[model samples]
Target: MRARNKPWADDYLKEHDEVVVQAPFDNKNKWQDFFGNDQPIHVEIGTGKGQFIVGMAEQFPEVNFIGIEVAKSIIVSAVQKSLDSGQKNIRLINVNAEDLRDLFGENEIDKIYLNFSDPWPKSRHEKRRLTYHTFLEQYQHVLKHDGEIVFKTDNRGLFEYSLVSFSKFGMELDEVLLDLHAYEDPKNVMTEYEEKFSAKGQSIHRCRAHFPHRN
Candidate 1:
């Protein structure tokens, strides 16, 4: 069944100023203007309600975070949540992840987070997956050398596909955990989806992939 369109998206359209980019893919190199300094910038491609990005921004004040969500209504809630939490280092863009290269310059991003991305189940729809080679190529254009993509998902098939994709693209994988909760690390930040799924006794699959040097 097709997902119903979110109605609250219209309300967010009225408060456009709160959103940093009205059309991100069109202005690829303009991101530097939004952040005056060259401090490391991290991006979250699909920030479903903004919990993870906001929490990370608050936790790491020294870094800047940019979240891109195609759903305007959800992004509005994320922006409002960030504002209410008194966070100053985060921004949201309403756009498709495919257009990331058009919005960011070469080697401009320091890190990327792909938390609980949509699992396009059909084999024919595999290209639509965020971890697909096409999207990874786009990410490579914007990510700095050694920049890493931290991905977490509850879908094992998708995780396996992503691992192969990353390796085929010459990216290195590390910190691969089939069950995130088993890890004793405090740096783990759970997203809204992760929290809900983990509560239901689901194991979260996660991994970190980095671009190899082009020597």
Candidate 2:
């Protein structure tokens, strides 16, 4: 679903002067300086409406969170959510995921969260899927040696495809849960879509993928 364009989104983002990061941000490798601390950096790509990342920032104050979204209209809502929550450990980026490597340096990001991402369920658009090999390669550049990507989705097709893609990229699947809500993870936070789908009795699929080398 396309978000209605809020003509004032850009103005609102600028005026709030909070988590919205104006790219291309300077001090790529010095992200800790931006947060004014040496905390580990975790990022959420396609952070729709910001529930998951914002909640994570609140849950884990020790980690800095960056929420990246391409749509200004949608991201504006995310920024507003962040403001409403009054969380200082998080930031937002209005940019394409393809440019993440430029925004962050190698080994700069400690972990990544992919929640309820677009399945892009078309044969011709396979490359556009976030779990595609092309996108995975970009993620690897910014992630630390032991960095992990935790993914969740309600779509089985996308989940299966992501599992294959991660394995093909030589990433180790440390955890896999076909029914995330059934699992006993008190720390598991839910995204907007995750809550919606789960309420409808849909089983959430989840997994954690990481490179083998810890160094």
Q: Which numbered prediction scores highest in lDDT against the true structure?
A: 2
In angstroms, the error of model 1 at 196 is 0.4
Candidate 2 lDDT at 130 equals: 90
Off by over 4 Å in 1: 1-8, 11-19, 23-27
Residue pair clashes in candidate 2: none
C-alpha RMSD of each candidate structure in angstroms: 2.1, 1.3
**Per-residue lDDT of model 1, residues 14-48, tens digit only:** 56555556666665765666666666999998887
Give lDDT tens digits, candidate 2, residues 131-169: 999889878988999899999999999999999999999
Question: For each candidate, what TM-score against the reference?
Answer: 0.91, 0.96
On TM-score, the leading prediction is 2
64 Cα displacement, candidate 1 (Å) = 0.6
